[model samples]
Target: MANKNHSDGDLKGTFYLVMALGVFIVVVWGLCFGLFLDRF
Candidate 1:
């Protein structure tokens, strides 16, 4: 039971980290694209 709890906590943490990273990537991509368009 203890092992299961630990695994669950780890899984939750990983899920959140992945989600945050994905958002960060998306925001950076948008900013880059905007700058590229401005250069034109």
Candidate 2:
């Protein structure tokens, strides 16, 4: 039971990590895209 709980926590941590990374990437991409548009 303890091991299962630990694994569940690990899974949740991994999910949050992936979500944060995805948001970061999207924000960066949007900034770059906006700058690119400004050039025109």
Candidate 3:
């Protein structure tokens, strides 16, 4: 039971980290794309 709880916590943390990273990548990509459009 204790191990199961510990693993659940780890999975939750990993999920949040992946989500944050995905959002960061999307924002950066959008900014770069906007800049490219403005330049061209």
To one decimal, what is the Cα RMSD in angstroms of model 3 from the true structure? 2.0
- Pairs of residues clashing in candidate 2: none
lDDT of 1 by residue, 1-40 (tens): 9999999998998999999999999999999999999996
lDDT of 2 by residue, 1-40 (tens): 9999999988998899999999999999999999999997
TM-score of each: 0.68, 0.73, 0.73
Candidate 1 achieves a global lDDT of 0.96
Clashing pairs in 1: none
User: Which wins on TM-score, candidate 1 or candidate 2?
Assistant: 2
Residue-level lDDT tens digits of model 3 in 1-40? 9999999988998899999999999999999999999995
* Per-residue lDDT value at 31 in model 1: 100
Cα lDDT for residue 1, candidate 2: 100
Q: How many clashing pairs per prediction, in order?
A: 0, 0, 0
Superposed model 3: Cα runs more than 4 Å off: 1-7
Q: Candidate 1's error at 12, in angstroms? A: 1.1
